[model samples]
Target: MSKIKDTSVNFENKKNLEETCAEIYAVNLISGQWILSICYYLKQGKLRFTELKNKIPNITERMLTLQLKKMEEDKLVSRTAYAEVPLRVEYELTPIGKGLLPILAQLEQWGKLHKSMSEGSAT
Candidate 1:
């Protein structure tokens, strides 16, 4: 068998690793403000476009459309269209999207605690 290696890292390596991780997390999760919320709602069940639009009251249909398109492109959501006299489309989280819920929950909890801390300090 080959000799084992020293896997420990130095200061520069640690800094680089941290920076890389932050960059990756931002790329994956920070692309759009509505993404996590959209995923959360879909986790409850599938929703039609109008239903989703109603759920997120602040978001315009145009903006929601764009965000959903991006999410679909990123493989985080799946859109299905039904063949009928009046076509109907529904959106739901893909397996990949469902995988993000726990992570989002943790981040959301962190954000809430951080916000409270900041407000307390400001007072």
Candidate 2:
């Protein structure tokens, strides 16, 4: 049979392009203001809604709820509710979310190094 040249590039397949853009997709998913922080906290262990609110003092209740809901929807977090007199809800990172810890740790290290360098230069 004669050689058939690939026409994928010429056709510009949107689905194929998106499938290859995982880095961009990841960045977009974690771009929310408190997403990184939330992931950091959850890395320690599961936490209740109020506990998360108390840990991150500056975050408003509405914002926390919204962020948690978004994270849950994205399959990055697992939410569990306990049946009791008082409603109890907890959130923990999913396996995929746990996979991001090393990346986050690297970012943390970079931030610290950058801060130190900036301070040294300022002096």
Question: RMSD to native for every prediction?
Answer: 10.6, 9.5
Mind giving the per-residue lDDT tens digits that candidate 2 earns over 1-123? 122246655335544555789876788678866999899899999999999999999999988998899899988999999998699999999999999999999999999999999999999
Alpha carbon deviation, residue 78, candidate 2 (Å)? 0.5
> After aligning candidate 2 to the native by TM-score, how far in Å is the CA of 75 from where it should be?
0.9
Candidate 1 local lDDT, 7-121, one digit each (tens): 6455457556558798654454435568877987898979999999999999988889988988898888999999976889999998988887887889889999999999999
Clashes of 2: 0
- lDDT (0 to 1) per candidate: 0.81, 0.87
Tell me the TM-score of each prediction against the true structure.
0.76, 0.81
Q: Which ten contiguous residues of candidate 2 have the minimum total lDDT?
A: 1-10
Clashing pairs in 2: none
Candidate 2: RMSD to truth: 9.5
Q: In model 1, which regions exceed 4 Å deviation?
A: 1-30
Model 1 lDDT-worst window of ten = 1-10
**Candidate 1 C-alpha error for residue 103, in Å:** 0.5
